[model samples]
Each structure stands twice: as structure tokens, then as C-alpha cells.
Target: MVDEVKETTVHELIASPFVGAYLVLRPGSPRGLKIPRDKYLQLGRKAADDVCPAWLVEATRRCWNLDISGRGVNDAVVVRTESPYGYGRASYGLNLGCNYDREHCYSTSA
Candidate 1:
């Protein structure tokens, strides 16, 4: 029998990182984030069970890349996107590498 599925919010979805390293680079992360293992596991299991849509999973995975470093997990990601107001969204993407095109080789905010 399928387990009863609970609806998770975008914030909750945003918070789950430690279920397993199926995609996330960090192990023991979900628990580390203080998310209950059972819940995290349940969520992961649900995702695996196809109750969660594949495109959503893939899209979410593709949307961001977590940066795990010696300093520990850097969940700070910055993405450049336009808001409905036409102003750029302040943040929401993974910061990867440096922009050589720019004069200063600063870390990419996103």
C-alpha cells in the first residue's frame, strides 16, 4: 500500500537537503539542517515513488547546484532573474566560478 503523502511547501522543499545524496553533494545534510530524518526519508521515498513529478525533481535539481566546501556546505546560491516589475531579482542562483570577462575575478554571486 502506498503511504499517505503529505503536501510539502516550497519553503519546506527548499529546506530538505539531507534525505540522501541522490543528487545533493552532502551526506547527513538533511538531518544537519534539523529536518527530521523520518520526514526527510519519507519525502525522499515519496519522490522516488513517483508521487512527486519527475520534471519537478529534475527541474529543481537542474535549477541549482549546492556548493560543498571545506568550510562546509554553502547553501548560498544566487541566480539572475527578472521580476514582474522588470527589475532583476536580488538573488536565487548558485554562485559558480569567476567571471573572467569582468576586470576583477570576484566570486560570482550567481
Candidate 2:
């Protein structure tokens, strides 16, 4: 039998501990060479299953499916979620590789 999917709101998904943990694992910016297609698929599936946000899952799926090279997993997520306020908020607090420099850190203003 097919399992019924439970509906979850953006707020609820963001509030979920699972989503929080998943976001912590995701990169907020590009940091390395592109992830291999096979690896991206594997990681994406794992992330989709672990997170409560439907949008994040979908974004992971679509980003991994792209043919572009040199894009890291976190870069994919950042590119996909940077727009549209809701998705952006869902991905907030991500480690964007600029946390050390006060002038460049997103949390700080120039």
C-alpha cells in the first residue's frame, strides 16, 4: 500500500529539528569542484528523505539533475533558494564561507 504523505507548512518545516540539522549540513556557497553526478544523486536523496521542507527536497533533486560542472552541493542549494523570501529564510544561517571576515560576512553590514 502507498503511504499517505503528511502536509507540512513552510513554518513547520523550518521549525523541524530534522530540517535544521539538514541545513547545517548543507553548504551555503560554492567551496569545491562539482560533485559527481552519482554522489550528488545519492546525497540529494538522503537530504530529501531527511528534511521536512518540500521545497528544499525538490530543490535538491532539481539541482543535482542539472548538467553543470564545478557546482558543489551547497552551491546548488544556495543558487536554488537565494530568491523568493520563503526559501531564502528556510536556508538561513548556512555557512557561506565568509564567516571569518567581518567585511564580507553576510551577517554583518559593510
* Best by the lDDT measure: 2
**Which stretches of candidate 2 lie above 4 Å from their native place?**
1-51, 66-102, 105-110
What TM-score would every model get versus the actual structure? 0.19, 0.19
lDDT of each: 0.31, 0.34
Best by TM-score: 2
lDDT of 2 at 12: 11
Q: Compared with the true structure, what per-residue lDDT tens digits does model 2 show for residues 69-105?
A: 3333333332222233223343223543334534323
Model 2 lDDT on a 0 to 1 scale? 0.34
Model 1's lDDT to the true fold?
Answer: 0.31
Clashes (candidate 2): 0
Error of 2 at 54 (Å): 1.4
